[model samples]
Target: MNQPLPQRNEPFRPGETALLLVDMQRIWLEPGADPSHPERGPDHYFYRHTAAETIPNQERLLKAARANGVEVLHTIIQSLTEDGRDRSLDHKLTPIHIPPSQPEGLPVTSLAPAGDEIMLPKTSSGVFNSTNIDYVLKNLGIRYLIVVGIMTDQCVDMAVRDAADRGYLVTCVSDACASATQERHDTALNAFGGYCWVADTDTVIARIEALGKSA
Candidate 1:
């Protein structure tokens, strides 16, 4: 008989866990923030979904994380060089370039980083590959990551999978994330479901509260 793998069911610990917001920049989340976003129109499903669901859930998660003393981190898709030389090959090929000082580089105001919160600027979809996020997380003694953000099928997916592969316990907040389409978001979650624990905003916040009580 094959031996069963050990299951992990411990609640999140405040000092050992972090909430990572991936690519929640204005260009992607806010309508009319980027020129192409305006072309997509204000009523586009992506914009509607974000405004109606993702951002609201993210606010809840942030509140819970902050109150529970879990570290919060943000990532933005940005280029280190003005000429777009520092971007990853994939970003270059996709022509995804957000200049460092562009207004689009800022996070949406509602869920913006608070005092002393860390923000990582990356030129690649996978923050682990592009930034010193691993080192920073390790330095902070973080073992578990709660991930929420934009482009569920891209950067968020990469963060979840990469963080799991690097031996971090990862939880993906489904309602706190979105993609260009609902189908893409659901498909990406299904594909990456094996890599991390999947939970909704309410469930995650409850877990945080439970941990706080325990602490």
Candidate 2:
């Protein structure tokens, strides 16, 4: 018999798994994007490194997901109204928050969802709070989530903790997510490691490949 996955094996069912890509909007991933311009300035090193490291890793993870027939879900952060009426409390407190881009935010080109893939639109850092993602996952009988995307210290971090609390087994692809700074990225993973297994793209890909359908 195949061994249970390294940790928290019972609930991490492959057939019940979904690969969640969080906040990969162009506003956060693209270098010259209007929302990211301030953070992508000539002197901004964090974004420079993020675009370099995170995007590629996310692309690799995406490829593996598609090839393996894994369910791919996307969560993009955006305010639902121009007047910011729907914005979350933490969003309002942010000093220079980016408003949601029109007709949904622009996702990075490489990460754009195919027409049929599920896209979870959200106004809060926690994907489950502002979106029907949890409901969808539950309906699909999903019990495990392989999470990846931008701003690891913020959206990705919150989503990970939220999913854990909601009783979903989660594996965070560390390299496939980014943050405002390396330190923040590391800090988030450190704190959340207790709630979820932290793995890189290679490890995640291998696990996905090895997963079996629950009968």
Candidate 3:
């Protein structure tokens, strides 16, 4: 019989943990926001799943994080330069440009950044690669991260792996993330499942709520 790997199932400490929302912008969440991708309409799998599962779960996670005093940070895809000359080479090659003033680049209204919440704008798929997020997280004393967001196979995957590489304990809220298809979402999670703890929204919320009672 094989022995199980030791787990880092430490309870979340409010002050040392943060909830990271990655690229949950209007461009991705609202089908109308990016007319360039007309195929992704209201009934598309991504949108349907996001509306049915991701957003609602994220709302629950956000509520619990806020109520329990956990740090909340949001990341959006936007260029620092109006002409997008500042975007990473990969972004330019992929033709992913969100002008500094683009409305679609802003966070979706439903899960918008609340008062005093930090918002980091990046042009790369990985927030840590394009923004000063590592420094900021270190400075804020954030040791553990609870991540939820769009394009689970891309930005969410990068965030999870990169954060783990940088030595921050990571928990990915699987239900709170969406990809273009269910297959993509599940595949991405399994691909990087080794990097972080994979958890559902309900489990994460219960943990956050328990933090309050533990105090």
Candidate 4:
């Protein structure tokens, strides 16, 4: 059997880390988008929110990470053309639609980082696959990645796995990510825990606060 990777014992070092927020678009949250799937609608209401509810937690993580001087990187699954010609086979299979320009200057989803934050566009699930994300992270000397976003089982999982494979310390804020169902979200978290630090929003907040104090 392969030896297990060691757990991260030390708290996050803010300056060396970046927070990556993945797709959290309104199209995935709207009621009529999937009428047959009630979970994706606004009615599931767990913890005063549904499975589509991840905006507040994402916003909190973004604020905390920014306050501590951690780099913020936002990723959206958009194609290079209006017809989505650059989309990957996986994207083509999924119903998520990303026009070439929807994420324009406004915040359609909690996915957008602030104006100063780095914005990366990807055609595949992992941000590093078709984008210059790796180059930008390398140039910034970022070695730790904090991931928070929508669809825990898809883009977020892919990004976390890729980051770990690339030798970055990865942390996934469970409370800040969501999926269409509890089963999907939980399953992904369980699998991801083997590769990355699976943490709650409170834990991440405390870690960021500690890092801020140390700085």
Error of 1 at 102 (Å): 0.8
For all predictions, the C-alpha RMSD in Å is: 2.4, 3.8, 3.3, 4.0
| CA-lDDT, candidates in order | 0.90, 0.78, 0.90, 0.75
Model 1 poorest ten-residue lDDT run = 5-14
lDDT of candidate 4 over 42-61, digit per residue (tens): 45543235333477777788
Error of 1 at 205 (Å): 0.1
**Model 4 misplaced regions, further than 4 Å:** 1-9, 33-41, 44-53, 93-97, 103-111
Candidate 2, run of 10 with poorest lDDT: 95-104
* Model 2 Cα lDDT, one tens digit per residue, 84-158: 777788777773344555633657788889769898777788898989888999988888898988677888988
State model 3's lDDT. 0.90
How many clashing pairs in candidate 4? Answer: 0
Model 3 residue 78 lDDT? 93
TM-score of each candidate structure, all chains considered together: 0.93, 0.85, 0.94, 0.84
Query: Is 2 or 4 the stronger prediction by TM-score?
Result: 2
What is the TM-score (0 to 1) of candidate 2? 0.85
Indicate whether candidate 2 or candidate 4 has the larger lDDT. 2
Error of model 2, residue 79, in angstroms: 2.3
The residue-by-residue lDDT of candidate 1 on 1-215, one tens digit each, is 99975343357876898999998888887777765555787898999999999999999899988988899999999998888899989888977899887976889898899999999999988999999999999999998899999899999999999999998999999999999999999999999999999999998999888868978
Compared with the true structure, the alpha-carbon lDDT of candidate 2 equals 0.78
